[model samples]
Target: MSAVSAVATDRAQADAAVVVAWCDELADITAEPGRITRVYLSPEHARVNAVVGGWMRDAGLRTWQDAAGNLHGRVDGSTADARTLLLGSHLDTVVDAGRYDGIVGVLMAIRTVARLTAAGPLPSAVEVIAFSDEEGTRFGKALLGSSAVAGVWDDGWWDLEDGDGTTLRRAFTDFGLDPESVGTAAADPSTLIGYLEAHIEQGPYLDRAGQALGVVTSIASARRFSVEAVGEARHAGGTPYERRHDALLAAAEAALAVEGICRASQHIGTVGTMTVEPGAVNVVPGLARFSVDLRGEFDEGRDRVWDAITAAFDEIAVRRGVAVEPTEVHRAPAVFCAPALMDALRTGIVSTGEAAPPALFSRAGHDAMSLGLVTDVGMLFLRNPDGISHHPDEFVAEADIALGLDALAVAVRTLTERHGTGPDGVS
Candidate 1:
């Protein structure tokens, strides 16, 4: 091989080694079964966070736990007023989730800072944040940490309850964090020049397109609702079929209606959960409840799906002489990442000689979306195997991870070199 080709190969191998080391370190933490369960200020999650805090401390980074349970590691730069380049991801996970899901971002940021510290002070500061809970596995709240920092989590949100009777505020105090001090996590708009995150694509778009990198254009809007059906319970064997007012049967009809709604909207609406209450073999169900999660590229599209779904449910309720109530859980509008940051990512991908970056929308929500409300936020999507994520089997090639890191480093370097991590330019 040519000398230049040989050097390129060597550099690639070195980069792969760095990513593997980070992945392995995090894997060790996640391998614990307790960490794999809903952490929710629970004993298991606290133990895991303590380990992570120690890692940060050993690196000479000062650590603090925010009111929302986010763990932040700070590295001071030339000026205290400097808005640091923020990196890292959530440490929380779905039950039995893979190690690399959210923890990879934190590990990558820590490793990058470790290298920078060895090289001497950077022009600007960099903060690695292991956000408290992004998966909502415990308390059914996503982006709790990032949202708190953005000043979006409020009193009502604080009282949010988990599947258990425990409240979020109680969980915070139990975890040795202050609930009232949650506001302190908010960043001064001027100091937050730009925020960047590196995460697995969690989808198949990049792998199918043969792209190693993804420049996220926007995060899709999501609406979640619960549907309930009320009907008279009857003995299955004693009641004639025509005289029966079966809630489960009505719920089944509503499920089909939901499928029709998704099909009419080209599969943007999804129904993931359905349950019939007083569930028994011999008794017809009197009450049924199901959840509908709908998402789309635009608010109008989402609204369209919502309207159709409600109309269909109404029609079903009347036809079956049953009552149906749909309760709104939550709704978030689509959020677009900074265009300038997207362009910067594209430039980095091109510079690395990787295939063209995929310009795509993230179907999954991220902390970046919450941060965008307060500061400039950007994200890079590392291609996943089969675009699958949130599972133990989710995989991303080492080569692709290296490619993503190279692109992330380029973007960070460019921002720091030009703007110096101050708030003046990022807006």
Candidate 2:
């Protein structure tokens, strides 16, 4: 779940009461639709599909669900063999999610289609994809839905299991999908024009800049690790300070070092999970484990930050007389926006009468990262006050959504005008 998974889950673990309520609701899956906690290939997933699919039809698009369970709605262009333009965001959410993180993008997309088709069919066919999984909450693998559409779905992922040990393959069958058909979900790269997604900023940049929208320049290059610090557990009362090798203390310092290093580098790092062994109040903790997520706009800069963080950890471990170990669990390279699409977005925003729209590099991952494999990708971000996302506090002003609808529609038109006659619609 934690691409921002750890962002909320562990960093805000103090919100145990809120977390419990979310878990309880998810236990029933049909639990009265209180707070969003939808995971992949579950009843909650199906429920949203039906609801959103209805809106798709109302927008004058034909709807269907792919083998990987991503929901899609499409309307053809006037020309024969018209290139397809993809628009959308994920429908799935982290536990106790905010209403708009992915939902708004999907809704805006359908509305954008309505605005476009109201005039006439676009030069390129338009398809809106409500990606089934981007949080990787259930199977601990992000981008399952988009990866399938990108034609990069891995068969090995079938064995991935949830907390309850339900393999992804089993979940597919349980959801009434054939695992063998997952490969069919891939969209033909030649036919696709590109993928554009409009999402909440997921950071404070736009809000602070006082801008309603920004053209995303790229998605962060990210790496996630499970880190461990080891020492001997001993009696708290009898052990002298000089003889103590407290692993927990060392891990704590490492966490602080992560913040310090990343802050100075203008990158982002999160030590989201931590656990200390031997729960007794009188026992000196001997084993400490934590999660580290490091991200930056560029790979080299991000990796440099990681090396610096590791060095800081090694120094802390030596000083605390503990051994530090880090195991990498996940990594994604930065996905840059298509220059033409970025320009289209820029023109689209400017068309809305804004002289200058900000250009930002996202620190959070999105469905675009996977879609980047199949086609050029671009993103438009709406302001979220203080960039607090993944929680209930995350928000986008209604006015911003209204403006975004116009902006995205114009952006699509700009794209169509620029590359309508091209085979791939890439300018």
Candidate 3:
């Protein structure tokens, strides 16, 4: 190989190694020993910021911890006032999390900027953010950090509490941040060129296709409902089958109906959490509750499934002599990728000498959904061999990481060339 090609190859190898090492190190910064479980505003969160901030600085960027607890690294453009291109993903993890899900994106962005600025500045600034929370595992609220950046933070969230009974506001104070200053984390939408995220496919599509990367077309719309079945408690041994009203039985039927409807349709549904009241060996359960999560490529399809589920609930309640209530606690509409950004990603994928990438709709929620409220957004998906995520067994090939880094760098260059300094300057 030529000397220049050799140097480039060595640098690519180094970048991949750096990202993998960072993932391994962050995996160690979990709340549980021997398992990964970092959450927002926790001690582990602070430690990660310190470590990642140092890497950002070493990569020749200005680093800071934003008021909402996100870590940021900024590389200036040709002009200090140039509009910025944002790149990143969440740093927080789900319970017993894998190393790559969200962390790799942040590390790869830093490395991408490092390579881009090795010689000189580009036409616009580049900033990488490591969002504080996206899993909603701690306080049952996802996108806390990204929502702040999007200027859509809900003030009512202050009262949200964790398992330890610590409110979000209290957690902020304990983490040495003023709760009132979170608003400062919001960015002016006009100052941003666009937002791009690199993430694992977390599904089998890319792996099944024998592909290393895919461009996201859109993220699925999702709705979450907390369902409750209420029935009278009675003596299990003395009460006849016809006389007893059982809440657990009703909830079970409802759960099955949820599965059956979603299975028959193109949508997806999950009964993730369940609870039964009045723990007793021989007594009828008085109440039962389960959380239902449904998603589809389109909002209308998702709503149709929800309507079916509700109809089933009504029928079950009437027949079982129970009351069923389904309260929608969360909803997010589908978000489409920006055409210009997708075009740039296509250029990047082609530059890698790989076949033209296929487009897939994301089933999982991402910070990109929240950020999409303000700016155009795009996503690149790295292959997950087993289509696994949110678990320790989730894995990504090292070679794929290298390809992803290269592709992201190329995409950034393409965007810079096409958009010049800002979206309005596209030529």
Candidate 4:
């Protein structure tokens, strides 16, 4: 290989190693020992900001923690006033999470900016954001950090409490953040060129296609519902089978109905959490509550599945003589990738030596979905061979990480070429 090519190869290898090591180190900064579990506004969040912010400073970027607790780092473009291109992903993790899911994206963005600034300033400014919350493990409100950035913070969320009965507002105060200043995190849409996120596919699509990277077409629309079946508690032996109104039984049938309807309609549905009342095994369950999470490529399809689930709930309620109610707690509509950004990502993928990378819709919701409310958004997916995520077994190859970083850098360059020359001249 030529000297320049050899040098480039060595840099890519070194960057990949840095990414892997950072992931391992960050995994150690979790609330639980021996397991990764960082939630919103927690002490771990502050620790991670300190570590990642230090790296951002080393990359020669201005760093700050936004009012909403998201960490940010910015590198000036050819000019200080140039339009900004945002790159990042959430840093929070689910319980017992894997190392690479969202953390890798932030580290990769930092490394990408470090490489760009080492050479010279680009045509457009680049900002890397480490969102504080995406898993919503503590308060059960996903995308809290990104939503604030999108200027969509809901006042009602302040009352939301965690397992320890700590209100989100109290948690904010305890974490040294003011609840009222969250609006400061919002960015002016006019100042943004676009948002790009590099994340693991968390599925088998790219792995099955034997590709290292793929461009995202769109993110799935999702709806989460809390369903409850209410029935009178009765003595198991005294109550006849015909007279028994079992809430657990009704809930079981409804859960099955959710699965059947979603399967038939080609949508994704999950009963992630369920609770049964009346601890006594001899007494009939008086109440049953379960959480239903549904997602689809389109909002219309997702709503249709929800409609079917509602009908099923009605049927089960009537048969079992129980009252069933479903309360929606969360909903996010599908967000499509902007055409210009998608083309740039395709260019980046091809530049990585892939013939034609596949385009797939993301079944999982991302911070991009929230950011899409304010600006055009695009995503690049790295292959996760096992199609596993949100668990410790989630995996991505180091070679794929290197390729993903290369593609992301190329994407940034493509954007710079497209928009940089007009307002801010490319260096």
lDDT of 4 by residue, 1-427 (tens): 1111211245666898899999989999999998999999888999999999999999898999999999999988897567888999989999999999889999999998898778899988889999999889899899999999999999999999999999999999999999999999998887788899999998999888777788999999999999999998999999998999999999999999999999999999999889999858999998999999999999999998899999999999999999999999888899999988888888877766776778999999899999899888999998898789999989887778887778788889888656753443221
Clashing pairs in 3: none
Winner by lDDT between candidate 3 and candidate 1 = 3
Q: Rate the local accuracy (lDDT) of all candidates.
A: 0.75, 0.84, 0.88, 0.89
Q: Candidate 1's residue-wise lDDT over 97-133, tens digit each?
A: 7767777777666655665666666677778888877
lDDT of 2 by residue, 302-391 (tens): 999999999998999889999999999998999999998998888777766677888999989999999998899999998898999999
Tens-place lDDT digits, model 3, residues 297-371: 999999988999899999999999999999999999999989888877876776666756879999999999988
Segments in model 2 whose C-alpha atoms lie over 4 Å from true places: 1-33, 424-427
Error of 4 at 27 (Å): 0.6
lDDT, model 2, position 254: 93
Best model number under TM-score: 3
User: Could you tell me the TM-score of candidate 4?
Assistant: 0.95
CA lDDT of 150 in candidate 1? 83
**Per-candidate TM-score against the hidden true structure:** 0.91, 0.91, 0.96, 0.95
- Candidate 4, which segments miss by more than 4 Å at Cα? 1-8, 421-427
Native-structure RMSD, model 4 = 3.3
Residue 272, model 1, lDDT: 78
- When summed lDDT is taken over every stretch of 10 residues in candidate 2, the lowest stretch is 1-10
